[model samples]
Target chain A: MMRNKALAAPFVLWAMIFIVVPLVMIVWYGVTIEEPIPYTEIVQPDGSVIYQLEDGSRTTEKPWQKRAVFSLNNFRRMLEPTYLRLLLRSLKVAVITTAICLLLGYPVALILTGRDFKRPALWLLLLILPMWMNFLLRTYSWMSILENSGILNSWIARLREAIPALDEWLLSMGVRRRIIFLYNENAVILGMVYNYLSFMIMPIYTVIEKIDKSLLEAAADLGASPVKSFLRVTLPYSLPGVLEGITMVFVPAVTTFVISQLMGGGKVPLIGDIIQNQFGKSSDWHFGATLSLLVMVVVLAFMGALGRIDKDDEPHKEVRIL
Target chain B: MNWKKNLRKAYIGLIMAFLYAPIVMLILYSFNNSKSRAQWGGFTLRWYHELFTDEAIMGALGTTLSIGFLAAAISTVLGTFGAIALFQMKRRPRQAMLSVVNLPMLNSEVVTGVSLMLLFAMAHIQLGYVTLLLSHVAFCVPYVVLSVMPKLRQLDPNLAEAAQDLGATPMQGFLRVILPDIMPGVFSGFVMALTMSIDDFVVSFFTTGSGVSNLSITIYTMAKRGISPKINALSTLIFACVFILLIGVNLQDLRRDPRKGKVEKVRIPY
Candidate 1:
């Protein structure tokens, strides 16, 4: 057994390099700013200023020699209104998405686990099948449906054409010919709910399905009403699952850029969109890392709180993966 | 009472509709003859033909598959051995090690992607296939370890010792007895890793460069610029493949053991 412990050495080393060091690199990039080294400008007889570099090399208008130094400048920049708004928007969207998934999913779980269903597995498979499709393609599908002149609006147009009275009523009610559905915060949230609904449903369903039927029977024997029995017995037992479901949905929903990009049509920018921008259009890795750290902190804090609440519960029956 | 039961069925039906509406829409438009996305455009197989002929899309599909297979295979070996080693350790260290393993999973995908991008940048490793592959394996090993750990905990510790006590050496005992018991967990872990690698987009986006991309990246760039019926065609084919693959895997499981297959199918990680 002692000798067997050596098998972990290779993975530990790999983890240190890939998993641990990369995170440290984020911190290294996050809190630092690049500043030009002090240089003396020397004017030559020809009127071309030969810049004296930090290393004492003379050059004709050489680009500023910038070096990375520890600073909280990025942190301060993160506190600015633009970034703060993005963070708030991300949280707002993530919270609403999670809430909607729970409200929509809990009942679905309950129904699936109910005694009437002879084959819940088949139905559950249908629920999860959409996830196996490519993520981008799924969002693109929503784009087709929710675009300004897309399927929903086209159907509305056809309806108004068939019924002129309905058209007059809508016109009198101050409704436009085409209602804008995409490119808004609501659209981003809709896309998120569509994608992550399964994460919420799966865990809650697992927990509810595992409840001992005898417990519900005992509650009934004591003359508890159906709702009362569910509130007391089923709800408490499934709390861990609910927490797990929240963690799973909330984490991805908060950190997502693609759903927002496609669904929001680049109009509604979340913190994720901004972080992705830093790496792409912005080209400021320092700022990107700073934003990444903020997201990391928020996610860790959320999971840590959930962990504390769930500490006394039994370990989760299965490990979750995307 | 009948109305109440009807209400439950109605609710489930509505949720299923919400879930599958997008997919059905994609499938519908994939065969549209006209290039415009909004119009009905008579049904034809033009986009499907285009989908098969497009070099960039096919190249991305190739890269996605090769990387997914390699990453899954490498992570399974490393993770299986790591789980075994962790199983042998004292409880305190094991718990600490497990938390470190969990970091990549628990952290935001954007953060994980960005951090890997930074790591590659700092280390002078070019952001391409190698970096992308490494990042996938990094995120994947944790899932593999987690899936295998539960199985290891359930195994009888003395079985290996008993086999050794007979005539077998330690390695032989492990190969003959312990390996067979834990093979299911390892296989599921491999499947999980494969799906994860294939499905990953956010991490791959940040950690890849130099004209190398996977299917998700290709779809994203194409969608961002404008809608394309070819994408619809590609997605339709991919969706069909996924549906068939899942059904095939499930069917094989059912043939092996009806009761266990149902449970295992339900146990598949999200």
Candidate 2:
């Protein structure tokens, strides 16, 4: 009993410092103001330049001020349509990305567990290894594939030299116009789907591996077709994975501005983009905190509702929760 | 049935191809000797050489490695104790604590990043290595706990009971009896924490204050400016490292853990 108590003290201490305090602080800061924008310099492409910006909002004499008061303006400003639109964009892309990830991941997982592949080890490695590399690095990789001067364009140009029909088709169809799709929500969806697909797979595979083979055999015996048996038996059993996959993909997808900005361009700001603007570009840490806190609340609410609904049919209902 | 079976086979092949295609493109582009980033000039080792010599990239690599090591170490100690505490508890408190530990893991990386940024900045604290290390440890604890908890669950509780009956202190029972059994679990937890710490950028990005860069940050800045084969070189290196680690883990599973092992390692690895 004494040893157990000693062991538990460390866990509680670490949790309070690292997890609980940080999360609570995010809320507390949401209601307070921080620095205003620092100085700015605008340099023209030619050699001329102009410069301007306010001092840190909390400070007065071009230096750090004493005793800055807390302000609520940051929270109040989030109601603007422009900001809300960004939030909606976050929702739209997150939903689409998560939906696509489920579609792509589920079919692949089904095939993996349903039948033995020639090199099962290799397939599993392929699924997992991309996840272990740098997240930003992988996101950057897609840039080469999607950009105008990148692989597809080069390939088309090569094909143009060899095949007149293909060259003419490429010229006529103008497939190069895909460069225009850059900085759009589709890019966000694609990036999110690619990044989080494995999360979907791991959980689904966990559940799928546990499913009794007899259940599938019984479904087949009932005279149901292959697809029907899958829909009724396999899909229902895998809902736990789907539940986890949604939260895993959706929250990041919605809040991620980097993938969208780098891949999609800064044209369509998601909630993440706006929050980033507040902190990095705008120097409105207070506003960013407000936006971030709002996102946390929404996530909490979204996850809470999902938990309530998903709990109804979870396998080992006690073990899995958000 | 024959046609349907053929279609299924084709579908599986297509999926595999899709999975393999992007990585292959990345590798092929890394060797594209041109600076245009678009046109593939020819195969060359030029960029890899460049990546090695670049001061900024190297600096970022150093930061990433240091943070990864620190965070992994912290996660292991806390996570090991947390897992054991849950195992020893009666029931309800254990369940609640386990759930709380898992909560951070379930949250999205972007959300976690943003929340940490707010938390750090609000406290009027500097956001640098400190925040990054703290948040990394926070998320990694769950992975360590999850990995260790399963192995703990599989052990026969009777062994510990027997150890106690033989005049062993609780500490002695755990150290001599439980530690040996859970060493593999601890190794797995360490592996997961290390990989996660290395892979993370979003959390690090938000927590890291201005100018203290890591590899992912440097790569991100470059990519933002424009696509560079330099980044391709970096990606290739990262991919190589991950590939080796994945192979190592899979090989270990094959040799060591029956449930995780596949048919490939009927042979030996010394």
Candidate 3:
């Protein structure tokens, strides 16, 4: 037993140093403010400069001196209306993306696991193959297809040229021949759904696949309709997968900077973009840390709610899929 | 009933098209001669030729492969051993350890990326290949642990004791009895680690510096300036390689258990 514990020591130490400490550092930086050097004029030759402190204490300090202090200023800044709106928009986009994925992915998963479907593994492999490509490159490919003068519109233009009446109707409806699809919130959502739909499908497919066929046979034997069997048995059983899929999609969707940057073109900046900017171009580590902490708290709360749903279903068994 | 089946097939086809349109465009544009994505001047193999000769891209690809290989190999050993030790622990302590292991898997990539960046900065470590590799290993360990734990649970606990009773040493028991049983899980863990390491962008972006970049980073930086057709060519080659590799792995698995090919479930952790 003693030797076994010793064997795990290195990994435990690594986790503590890398995982635990970095989290603590985020919280610490989030709450603490770096004291800026006070502006003061040198009126005397005694090496003293006057500056006002937070407590309104007038002090004469040595030139170029600064002190760190605890403050809620970063949190206050995070609550500003601009930041709040960005957070809200991010939530909205993430929710829409998750909903769309569930609608599209659930049916696909059901069909893939159906009795009539052949070569399910090959189809699943096809679904997962695109993920192996560089994600940025994948998102960038969408640009060529959706850009105003890109493939889709050019195809539309060719069709319109063949049908003069349809072109005239479109022009009369105040629609431009070239539809600008990129650099908007809709484009960002489309990009996200394209990237994350696979995640939603895989979990639901696994859960539905794991459902014992005998249970459904028994339901049919009991004279229950197919829809009734589905609702009573399949739907309830797949709640865990649904919750898992939601977490998988919502978490990344809300926090991803890459999709929004590539698709939004800096116009529809989300909270993630702001957080990334603070670290990259803005160079405000403290504020960035605060935003990260905020995101972490919200994510934890979201997971906690989903976990409660899971526990309600299977109270005794500890179900951890991920 | 026939129409219902046709409807299902058509729905599957539509969704598959949605999933594959961007990928299809990437492959098609690789053969396009024009530098502009919007135009198709002619069919040309110029970009494919350039891809082989581009030094920066070749260097980035080298870094990505080496880091992925090293991270996966190191994390698999550590995580396998860690899973073994953890299996011996009491229930409460084991759960606690497992949760800690899962932290990296659950946390947002951006947070994990920035936090590691901050850690490296605080420690005064140069942010380059070493830092990037360390962070990759750190994140990849949790996946390995998760993958291996399920297999460990499926194992027979008394097998090791049975070996010991036959005068076999602990090391001998582990190598001869335990290792063979857990080979599938270990293999899946290694594959998962390698895939995660290679596909990673956000964490790698934050933790790397001194001009050391991976394929994802190179793509992202180039994307800002409108990605060249050479990238399209490179992506096509990569897709072909992965397609072949997937076919090879599936064929090997089918050879092992021909009847299970259609119904085999990939044992992903989540």
Candidate 4:
């Protein structure tokens, strides 16, 4: 074992250089801001200002240079109301998505794990196959369904034409000819749930599928009803999986830019979108790093809390995306 | 009781419809003759033809596959050795190492992406294929290690020692005895790493330089401008490939043991 322990040295080194250093780099970028170097402005005799540099070199032009110096400017900016609102909006969306996924996904997992259910593998595969497709494509496909003039709207329009009285009744109730389903906060949540539903189902299914049947029988023998047995036995056993599912769905939901981008149509920008903007259009890596540090801390805090609750569960056996 | 069964069936059907509606819409619209997404002018295969001929899409596909392979290969080797080493270490050190390995997988992709981007910027390494591949490997190695670990745990620790007792050198013992047992895990890990690399968007989006993009990035940029039927066409093709690959892998496992391999990759991580 001692001799074989040397085998991991290369991987350890790789992890340190890649995994550890990049995080340290984030912190480095997070805590720092570019400040213009202080200079002594000397009024030149020729009606021009000369700048005295830090090293006492005189230049005819004003010194407008900035250096990356340690400052909490980015952190302070992060605390601004605009950024705080974005953070709150992102969390709100993520929480909604997680709740929706749990509500929708738990039953799917329960049904598939039922003893009466045949070929659960095939069913699970059917559930996960869509995820195997390109994630961007999957999100993009929703546009066709939910867009104002998209399929759903078109179908509703046709139905309204076919039933004129019903259409007039709907018009009286203030229903638009074409529903604006896409490009909003709810649309973004829909995208998240559609994409991440399997992530919720898979873990819950895995844990519930492994729950001992005898425990249910024992509960029944104790005069517990089916729902009572589920509450007393199955629910308690599935807590770890539920937590895992929530983490899986919530973290990605919170951190997602793509779903928000495509579904929200830039109308509903999450913290992820803002962070991406800082890197892309904004070109504020320092600010982006600050936002990223905030996201990382929030996500880590969440996972750490979940990890504590499910500490008795084997951490290694938590297979993500399976 | 009969109604209960019917209710379950109906529930499953409803969920399936919700899940498949978008996918079906994409597949249906791929063959659309009209350029507009709302109306179906007529059925045509023109989009698929354009999908193949489109230079940007083809180029991105090539880059994606090449990076997927290279990253998977590099990570599998690194992770295999890392897993073996971790298995041999004392509990405290092993736990520490495992948590470090989990960081990239557990961390938000945006954070991981930016952090790596910063690292590359600091190192003065130009972002392109190399940085993209490196980041993919970095994130992917953990999956490989996790996949292979259970296999290592299942292996009798003395098997390698027994091979040594039979006059085999440590490397030979490892190659013959330990490798065979862990091959399934290694293979699965390789496939896992490959799929992960291919499917990745966020990490590649940040790490890749201009004029170099994977399919996901290509699709993202194209999609942002508006919907293109060509993307729908490309989605159909990718979906077909994934479907076949997953079915083939699972079927192979089923053939090996009917009772086992019920799920695609229920690899029990140790």
Candidate 5:
């Protein structure tokens, strides 16, 4: 018992210091207003401002007493159209990315599980190799590829002469044949899918592979088409993995700021980028907290849904990846 | 029957093409002699040579490699023991424990990153290599646990029983029987954690302080400023290293077939 206590103490202490307390602070800072706060900020669209409170209390004088005031002004600000837009944008991006990832990753996973592919291990290795590269570089590499006049566009340009119809189609789309992708929604969504798709694939592949070959064969024997067998027996058996993979991908992609900032030209704002901007630039911990709280609510709702879906006490069967 | 077969073939090809496209472009462009990153100005060995001697890049490389090694070593030791302990517990408590271990993997990187940043602040300490190592270990432990526990659970309990029956101590039985059986899982877990730590940017970015820069941080800074040619060179080197490790891991999986390889590996039998 004493030995157990000794081992457990460090872990308990570590979580207290590292995980539990910081979580407390995020909630706290999210509620408490901070420096350069929204007192009387007015914006004229082209960078002019007559900034004063609606109450007309102008203070160039530093008020020491008001320095650490905690307030609901941040939470109230969520009513703004801008914050609403950011939340909607983040949700849209996450939903589309998850959908695309499922579509792209499912077929790949199915192939990995299905027999007859020579050297399936090699294919998995190929899938994971880029994944092991430094992530920031991976995101930036998209920049190099998607940049106007970059390698991709240049390739398209070269290909265009050889295929005149392709060149005409590219021109008709208001895109230079040299460039099909650069600084757009497609780039941002594709980047997220590229990074997190493997997380989705690996788990689904594990589940699909674990499914009994006999079960699949039996379904076919019962006069079901191959696709029907997959949709009925295969898909239902693997719903746990789908739920797991979606949650795993959704939470991170929705909350991440780096990919959008680098790839999306910062022309569009997601809740993540907005929250980061508030804290990093505006120094508004309270509003940032509100944003964080919103993200937390969305995440919690998803978790709640997942909990209900997985309410069954039976152990979800494991599917070996081989 | 024919359509079923045809669909599978087409599906396999499409999947292969998608997986290979980015990597093929990456390798092809690395050799492009173009000073402009977009236009391929023909092939050359210039960037590869340039990558060899760049001192700051080399420093970041060294920092990243050492951090990966240290973090993986620490996580592996902790995780191996944690796996053993958890395996000895009853199923209900074990399920709860497993969920706790998987938390870091499931949580958002931004949440983890921001929370770690707050953690460093509340502790009132400067972020440095040590801070980075500690955070990496906390998360890496979970991954190592994920990899190790499955193998531990699938282990044949009777082997240890047989060893004990032969008059071996509990320690001896475990060391001889269970430990060897789970070693591949441990090794793979270690490799996974190592790759994760080395390649990670979000966690490293939040935790790392001055003089603790790594490869991804350097690239992020470069990207923010504007694109650079040296980034391609640096990335190419890192990609080459990752690709080699990836191929090595896949080769292990291939050779793991009992009929083929000398080592008859034990897997987590589902």
Candidate 6:
């Protein structure tokens, strides 16, 4: 018994140092501010002249002389309209991406798990294989495909050159010769869905695949049509996976900096872009910590709600066909 | 019924295309003889040659693989032992520990990255290999724990106890009984940790200093200056390696447990 406790000590210590301490540091930095530059008047060598102490503070000053003070300034800055808009836009884009992924992925998952589907594992592996590639490489490839004068546009140009009437028709429609696809919110969402669609598919596929076929058979025996059987038997059982999928897609979509940077071309700055700026270009750690805290709270609240729904479905496990 | 079946198959085909189109573009463009991604001049292996010889990229790849392996191996040991200890612990303390374990998994990656950056800044620790390794291990442990915990829950509680009762020492009982039973979960956990570590960018970006950059960071920095086709070649090679490895593993599993492999058509759930 004592040995078991002893064995746990190292991990516990590690968690406290790395996991617990880092979070505490974020909170600490978030709610605090460094002392602003002190202003003082100094007498110059010429008695009539006065000097301002701008560049240099006293070298002998105690470290506590420039103490960090607790402040709500960082949080207050977060409420600025620009920052708030970015947060709202991030949420909107994430929500849209998640919705699109579910719409596109759920059907794919269902079909992949179909009774007649052969070699489902092989198909599933194919779906997941792209994800193992470097995420940056994946997004960069999208840039190559979607950029103005890139593959799609060049193909369109070729089509127009082949058919003069097509060129005239496009000109008559007031559309530009080249369609610009990058550096916009739509491109960011496209990137998100592309990168995260597999995440949505995997979880929902796992859940739907686990559904007992006998339950569907039972539903059919009761005269339930295929759709009705699906509604009653499959949908309810797959809710946990759906919620899991949503969390998986939505969290990353909301928080991804690289996707927006690469695909949006820094034109559509999300909250993630802003937070990254604070740490990088802006160099405002306090403000960055505040934004991180806000994102953390939102994610936790979202997961907690999903977790409740998961717990409520626990009693229904016995109804599983397996 | 015939149409419904055809529709299902077509839908799967379409989604597969959607997922694979970018990847296919990447692989194709890797062989393009042009520096411009927009134009395909001709087919060539120049990028592959460049990929092999680029010292910066090769160094980053070395760093990434070392970090991935080391972090995964260390975290697997910690997480496996941690899971076993927590399983034996009382409910309240176990719940508390488990939640902490889940924190890194559930939190936003941005938050995790920023918080770790803050910790290093406050502690005045230089953000380099050690910080990178620590952050990787910290985040990777949760995945390991989650994987191993399920296997621990499924074990017969008295398996180890029975071995002990048979006059085996407690450590011997654990080695002979519990370890073998949990090997599958441990193996998966290690793989999961490795994948997460390798794929990581955001946490590694912030936690690692400029001198110590991983492949993801290298790619991100290169992105601003237009990603070279060498990256595409490298990715194509990686994809091929993983694909062959997966096929090999599946074949091995079929050989070892033919019946079980046939019974469970879908071997991995997540």
List TM-scores for all candidates, in order.
0.93, 0.84, 0.92, 0.92, 0.82, 0.92
Candidate 2's C-alpha runs over 4 A off are A1-3, A34-72, A116-121, A154-179, A308-322, B90-92, B118-125, B248-270
lDDT of 5 at B38: 52
Off by over 4 Å in 4: A1-6, A39-65, A308-322, B248-270
Query: Would you list the clashing residue pairs of candidate 1?
Result: none
Better of 2 and 4 by lDDT: 4
Q: Candidate 2: give its CA RMSD in angstroms.
A: 7.9
Model 5 chain B scores worst on lDDT over the 10 consecutive residues at B261-270
Q: Please give, as one word, the docking class of candidate 1.
A: medium
> Lowest summed-lDDT stretch of 10 residues in model 3 chain A?
A313-322
Candidate 4's displacement at residue A20, Å, is 1.0
Scanning candidate 4 chain A in windows of ten residues, the lowest lDDT window is A313-322
- How do the residues A1-322 of candidate 6 rate in per-residue lDDT, one tens digit apiece? 1376687788889889889999999999889988855656554566543424456654333233454679999888899998899999999999999999999989888887886565676778788888889998899889988999788889899999999998999999997889999999999999999999989988898899889989998999999999999899999999988988999999999999999999999899999998999999889888898999999987888888777322311111111000
lDDT of 6 by residue, B142-202 (tens): 8888888777877777676677678887778778898899998898899999999999999
Chain B TM, cand. 2: 0.85
Task: Decide which is better by DockQ, 1 or 4.
Answer: 1
Q: Write the per-residue lDDT of candidate 1 for residues B103-209, one digit (tens) a residue.
A: 88889899999999999999999999999999999999989988898888777777777787787776787689887899988998898999999999999999999
lDDT of each residue in B1-270, candidate 4, tens digit only = 989988988998999999999899889989989998878889999999888898888898999999999999999999988887777666667788888888887898999899999999999999999999999998889889888888876777677767877888777877899899999999989988998899999999899995899989988888867767887888898898877876776566666766644543433221
For candidate 2, write residues A119-149 as lDDT tens digits. Answer: 4545656676666556666676676677677
The alpha-carbon deviation from the true structure for residue B121 of candidate 1, after best TM-score superposition, in angstroms, is: 0.8
Separate DockQ for every predicted complex: 0.53, 0.38, 0.48, 0.52, 0.32, 0.55
lDDT of 4 by residue, A108-206 (tens): 999988855556866787788888778888888888788888888888999999999989999999998988999899999999999999999989988
Write out fnat for all predictions, comma-separated: 0.62, 0.39, 0.52, 0.62, 0.31, 0.65
Instruction: Tell me the lDDT of model 1 at A15.
Output: 82
